[model samples]
Target chain A: MSQPIDKQRRAFLATASGAAAATAVAPGVFLHAVAEAAPRDSAVSDSVRYGMLIDTSKCAEGCTDCVSACDRENGLDMLLKPEGASDQHWDMQRPRWIRQVKLKNNLTGRVTALPMMCQHCEHPPCVDVCPTGASFRRADGIVMVDRHTCIGCRYCMMACPYNARSFIHESVRLKPTATPRGKGCVESCNFCVHRLDNGGTTTACQDACQHGAIVFGDLRDPNSAVSKALAQYPSEQIRADLKLNTGVRYTDI
Target chain B: MSKIHYREWGIESPRYWGLLAVLAAIVALGGFATLYMEHEGHWVTGMTNQVVWGTPHVFAIFLIVAASGALNVASIGSVFGQKMYKPLARLSGLMAITLLVGGLIVLVLDLGQPARLIVAMTTYNFKSIFAWNIYLYVGFLAIVAVYLFTMMERKANRYSHGVGVLAFVWRLILTTGTGSIFGFIVARQGYDAAIMAPMFIIMSFAYGMALYLLVLMFTFNTDERPLGDMVVRRLKNLLGVFVAAIFYFTLVYHLTNLYGTENHAYEAFILRDGGVYTWVFWLGWVLLGMVVPMGILFHPALGAQRGAITIAALLVVLGGLSAIYVIVIGGQAFPMSMFPGYTVIESGYYDGVDGMARAYSPSLPEFLLGLGGIALALLATFVAVRLLQFLPTSLADEVVDPHLAK
Candidate 1:
């Protein structure tokens, strides 16, 4: 019985090899396709480093499309004030994944508009200061919080240089299917990991930008839009002096 | 040489019960405040996304650092072999444990998810300073407990020195870990300096000694125990030295920051421009906390007076709180330099537009919670002294100082 099973396996292998040869497809391309088709729950490979490059020169001064789109996508827009909280108080307390910032050069007086979020540093201080390892960086370079492990110490908020993280100040309502948020956890820009896992390449902000100022792609892929754009135009990380080597880059800051 | 005797405070006065009642009430109020804050979320507090840590951290860090410093008297007795300090060692150990528990309670209750404390304990993040602190704190508690046991039990006395030395080393590392929590953050301009660790060590020395002195005087006076001028003077001088050391460290820290051109704006904000921060630094910390306390402790007329010494100790505690406030809240109030050359004209996330500092005002609940930690520490000390033979009936010069008896 063992010999017959071995003989059958050999025959099957021969037929599979013959079919592969007939197709004449490159082995590397075939393997790449197979890897891409694998389940999302499989560990994230180091081969892909997701990054974003923002062309601030093209960003409109008053536009909040990216900010509003991120809020809608993350269900941040659906947040409600506590029973008696003032609008101003609630505004300051609410979590924001992205914000439109207008900057002006002190000396040159040149104005620039851009949307700022998590820079997703290669070495995140938030991850380092978190007592419970709740603040973590994925293998693909997206920085996120594990809600289950986050004890709401807000040490990550204290450690974050970008001021990108927000603590849920009130009980959340109508949380989106993609983002699972609650009271007493730190949340930040995840680079839309939910969208990425769902086979979407672009973030909500990138998709909503009418000026095409936001470019999101795999940094490891040299031909990817973000990589090509970064190579063509000089881009600098926010707080470059800290040497955090951020996944997000900006031009004409 | 006469054997020193230790006795439990056997006072049954209504005043004692009144004191306990007041402290318990404060703790209960603090518990209520904590539950309200936790249920309603941090929104009820003055803490914001910009100033994430507020008044509670100031009080908690002060108490935590003071807890490490409170053990200095015990270390002096056991490790340094100061015969005069031996009788006071038991109370020192008790205070150390009590203060630590009090501070930790405030810190845990302030968490976003206080109920998830078990997760914080079980999970390990070796790379994080916060995680390392958990170990340091627990280890300190255990070591100090053993040290206390060695001091109290006759058979364990021989091993006291070894355990005392271990406790000393652990404490230094513990305080260093605490300081590193702020020091390691390279992102914030105010806290990246390596001096923070040593500065916190020195600060713990000053704050802890001052608090210890006050507790020692209050307990002895209330129990009608004879506290000696010799012992009081020694502790007072020690506190003066620690306070002076704190001043020196503060000077060195600022001078180092001033040397760097990058720190100029930050230094200016703390020293001159920062509204409440500037006042708190100069007046609350520098003048009232250090200068007045130092002057009172060293004055020819005032130094010898118990009343003056008590006032000085109180001042040191106030100053310590102010200093922590400046470091924790003020450090965060200043905006991060996200764009070095460019100024933020407008931002949606209260990112300190136009180089403005983030606003923070402590709410009633925040203050109540902080006060609760203090009350808890006092209550623990009060109860322990009443139950255990941690205090001597007398610390009079003839009793504590053998040379004087001779």
Candidate 2:
């Protein structure tokens, strides 16, 4: 399936007539124009389902560029170690949006390295188990936690198959404008929603990967980079047995 | 038949005052601990990204499960028509309400954002088992209270049996909801079994009965009232049977898990090489909790003695706690196998490195918070018994059992 090919039309109309002409267009079409034109305050639509494709064979071992980029983008790196907390304890307690994972086949002894984060499943267990409906999936298929409503019972953390979600243990003093994190709320990868909302076409991790291993685009659009990569390469979800229909796809691992 | 007369605990001795003081102190300490944890965040506790639920959950779940089973005494008298158990029915309903309140307090206080509990109450995802549990716990308190009222009021006594039956069914549903909280989680190897629901039901029967017996003995003895051998003997025997049922379910749960090729690693972790968890399972749950208690409860000489029976009951309580610990903490300790056939060689996250169990040591704040829940339950029971006519005047063989009276 492809999105209605109107980027050129919207881009031309945005430049020629600006906001006044946009009001005459239908809401769906106007939002599409807003998304294309990099408007800061545009409602996300289901017309595009964002996803990612990771080529694990091309992902270099010991490379933490994607992980570091995610930390910076989400303001996770801004968190400081609480008073008297040991390094070992801090490592386990801290929130992580994404992390590098190296896997070895038990029998074949094949070593594969890739970045692990939220799979953004069509059927997310975390979303189903949240008692207050704090964990929700956006219309564009991004799963995120509503920190304001989160009671921080950690039931979502328990239900997550990917172990991708993290609970912010101690109080957070500093955070980026894009992300508002606090103690006691469960959080995970939202595929750079701030970047997407600002009309940026790429994720922090995808931009940081020097090897061009990470592809980020709308999966529903057949012509998008992610869809093209998924069709070209043999890719699989981390836990395919659960049939979660994950948006994040991996190859050669 | 002589009518059973109810009375409040009247003798305000130094021991009674001392007991109340101690319970209050512990409850205060628990409140302080909760504040400390809240201020510092959960980082102060043993819980981490891997093991989210910790000691508080163990205490909360045990009390909640036992709260349901505590009502079984009343269910026997009112629903099953056991005349011998009718005298203890008031205390049974009271204990049910108190224990549930205590457990729910712990559950709410232990949340990462405890201040936002109102959000949990107002907004709900009905699909979640946690949300269903909110209703179950509240309904249990309400139903048990109404059941208690029906039992105590002479004019309302006729409706006691009908209310008792409803309370009985509601407790069953409550336990089922509690069990389904873990059972419904398909992500973990340790959980996701349909058997968890029924296993938890049996567990409630065992744990609840054990605590009820202890409370009965303590209260009756303190009041200098007559408690008969016939009633105690019957309770001990029932406790023994409940212990045996727990064993059967534990065996079935493991046997089923062992049969699944995918579950083999998890089974081995809990049964064999998982150092702390394995010992807790064998020694804490099986040895001290079950085997020792069963031995004392079944022996003709030991089972007949009140002291021996109390020891057995205490052991059951300890065992029940251990069983919950093994289920909650141990289950979480074992990492979810993200890549079924591959070993996670390296990762920033633990990722069950080298297939080892994640470390979790319960913190002081969490432990105190848990004890606070226990203390709160005991204090409530004590105050309720003293202020209200929850205890019957006598449980003598002649008074309780009509055959013995003749």
Q: Score every model by TM-score.
A: 0.94, 0.94
Q: Compare the candidates by lDDT and give the number of the best one.
A: 2
**Per-candidate local distance difference test:** 0.92, 0.93
Residues B1-406, candidate 1: write the lDDT tens digits: 3589999985667978999999999999999999999988999998888889999998899999999999999989888999899998999999899999999999999999999999999997899999999999999999999999998999999999999999999999999999998999888889998999999999998898999999999999888899989999999999999999999999999998999998998999999999999999999999999999999999989999999999999999999999999999999999887788778999999887998998888899998999899999999999999989999988999988777887
Chain A only: list TM-scores of all candidates. Answer: 0.84, 0.84
> Candidate 2 at residue B252, lDDT?
95
CAPRI tier for the interface of model 1: medium
Measured on C-alpha atoms, candidate 2 has an lDDT of: 0.93
Please write out the lDDT profile of model 2 over residues A1-253, one tens digit for every residue. 9788788998988787867666677787977786677765567788989899999999999999999999999999999999999899889999888989999999999999999999999999999999999999998999999989999999999999988999999998999989988888889999999888876889999999999989999999999989988999899998899888998999999
Please report how far candidate 1 places residue B39 from its true position, in Å. Answer: 0.9
Tens digits of per-residue lDDT, candidate 2, B1-406, equal 4789999986567988999999999999999999999999999999999999999999999999999999999999999998889998999999999999999999999999999999999999998999999999999898889999998888999999999999999999999999998998888989989999999999999999999999999999988899989889999999999998998999999999999999999999999988899999989888888899999999989999999999999999999999999999999999898999999989889988778788899999999999999999999999999999999999889988777877
Instruction: Give the TM-score (vs. native) of candidate 2.
Output: 0.94
| CA-RMSD of model 1 | 7.8
List candidate 1 stretches off by more than 4 Å: A1-38
Off by over 4 Å in 2: A1-42
